[model samples]
Target: MNSGTKQHPWSRYVALGDSFTEGIGDPEPASLGGYRGWADRIAEVLSAGTDDFAYANLAVRGKVLRQIVDEQIEPVLSLRPNLITISAGGNDVIRPRSDPDEVAVRCEAAIERLKRDNATIVLFTGPDLGFSPVFRGVRGRIAIYNENLRAIAVRQECVVADLWALTEIQDPRMWAPDRLHLNALGHHAVARSVLSALNVANVLQAYDPEPMPDGTWRGARTDDLVWARTYLAPWLLRRARRQSSGDNLLPKRPTALSLNGPRA
Candidate 1:
């Protein structure tokens, strides 16, 4: 490699985390996982800049921080890519039974290893979960996790793609009907932010926000009943059974490949 050559934030990029990194709500027809997320979106933009640009997404839909570190740490360290982003821990701390301190400790350990690589590591805090009445109780835990994440980023010298301060993330329309994952627009907002943080060229050009909801609470109780019956009940059953959304699923894009190339 030429020492004087400029790098474009990433030539080899990798993403790691949970559902948010996996693109749960943003539908994709070609991939079996059925979604294309911020990582993919950023990869596409990078691909436009250089044919050498490649990307890998190892994020599954439901892994917690420790699991993510266990599954991803060695592979990512081996890959030694120039860029990486991790968006985990939400699945762990969102539950009433989980410990925020433990999750943070696991995450800090993971970030320390990621920092050992020459690659730039980008980190995103889980957005405010309080907007959903169902997760209101866990807001304190999420807040604590966010604070820990911010401190960890500083210590690791990793770029923090801060989500907690994003004003519009609290809007009802920014989320999916399930109220746990982000909808299309919410994903777009995140992608934009992630790219901007990377100083990717013309990131603002990717702007396509989901419109805020009108009369979102026109029939609050009726909607709550539907939400509970449709999404909450199944989630509880999964927890009781010790199951996960990513169970039987695989990363949609597991190996680094150019955006215009086939997945490896």
Candidate 2:
């Protein structure tokens, strides 16, 4: 930790990644682009302090690490941010043919570039997918991916959010209706995690999610059918067509600007 880091807020904070960083599932009607995920939450808090803070979020949903590197790494460096975060590769690792070693190397490379630019790189270990029935097949791969992230953080001196360690998020309520993304409460927990890692005090507490429907076996089966009909089927169709949810989407904040204070 730098002596002056606490004395001054980050002048420029750039966030780069995929849907997780893009604030999916946690929709905020008032927020720009109708999303308010962890990065936005943290940025809001940072901007509330006495020191000025400029923030930019360039994350889009469904991005892989290579695509992030190809499309974003240079842009983030160009912004010359004091703090930058890179959280991606979830989409990549889940593929049937993914190579863990290659993905790890790519992640490390991204961190190395951030270090070269002299930014405090904050990385995230993907959340444990074992809790999701549909994602169970990739649980082993995700474990390996999380392991790689921890090792990379140790070697690169980057902060890892360690989402897998947060038992609070394992609950069904932490997930969105689709069971693929996090709901508002889950995003809040992740924001708290990131804030804690940055040694920032978070007044934005993680709260109990809104009450859910029946959790009994019969209820579960009913809900599962609903989910498949509502979300999972459409998602699979999109994947079959090689269309991304973010194909036409743009970053919520394409340029850095002073956050001034928390959004109401």
Candidate 3:
């Protein structure tokens, strides 16, 4: 796990986003409940003990950009994280009343607030929802969202993770049965992408892109993956399957289940 260079272990990281940041499709779901996620993985790679640094994942499912600003962003400022990673905007895209321009503005404001604390910020854009049949007609909107995110990253001097491009080249197995959420492999891909962007060491050193158990899709089965399925994937699949079968399990929205953004 060595990077052939001296690097100080990160002492604190505050992760902000939705379900994707929560590792929704990881194999074993129980492990991801508390502070577990890519941010936790990165923290472990950089440091030896949990007390050495605090990694907090302040993400919740079905949270839009405004919600993150109110809930996660404001409270985390007090932690004074040495590093921060935000994976947001998916819910904003999927919601029926989503205004892309307002989302961009909110995102920009969030980034600015983070900058005031002077932590190394990594801002991840939404993945390519276009690849899924559910999001078939809104590829253009996804693209515009990503473009605005990139602009904000540039303006605010934040590192950007090109999640859209990374997911675009992947096969179907990378996504969960619901197709909107990332499977185990997709989560690893996202972790690696973020690590590479930050020049972090040993984060993905032992990464293996394999599928989960129960004859599921293709991807890696890291601890994070195990956590994802046990907790997050089952409900997602149930909802998706129910919706596909014309069952009204959840609230009715303007878009199909597949078009529900990045499972976040």
Rank candidates, TM-score, best first.
Answer: 2, 1, 3
lDDT of 2 by residue, 185-228 (tens): 88888888988888876556556445355488988899889999
Better of 1 and 3 by TM-score: 1
Q: What is candidate 1's TM-score against the reference? A: 0.88
Cα error, candidate 2, residue 200 (Å): 1.0
Q: What is the overall TM-score of model 3 with all chains considered together?
A: 0.73
Off by over 4 Å in 1: 1-7, 203-221, 261-264
Could you give the C-alpha RMSD of every candidate to the true structure, in order shown? Answer: 4.2, 3.3, 10.0
Location of the lowest summed lDDT over 10 successive residues in candidate 2: 1-10
> Candidate 1's residue-wise lDDT over 1-264, tens digit each?
222222365688889888898888778787536787667777766666476887788898878777788888778777778899999888888776788888989888888788776689998887776667778888899889989998898888888888887756677777788888887777777777876777765433333653754664657678779999999899999988878988777777777777673221
Quote model 2's TM-score: 0.91
Can you rank all candidates by lDDT, best first? 2, 1, 3
Q: List candidate 3 stretches off by more than 4 Å.
A: 1-9, 27-36, 48-51, 167-169, 203-207, 212-264
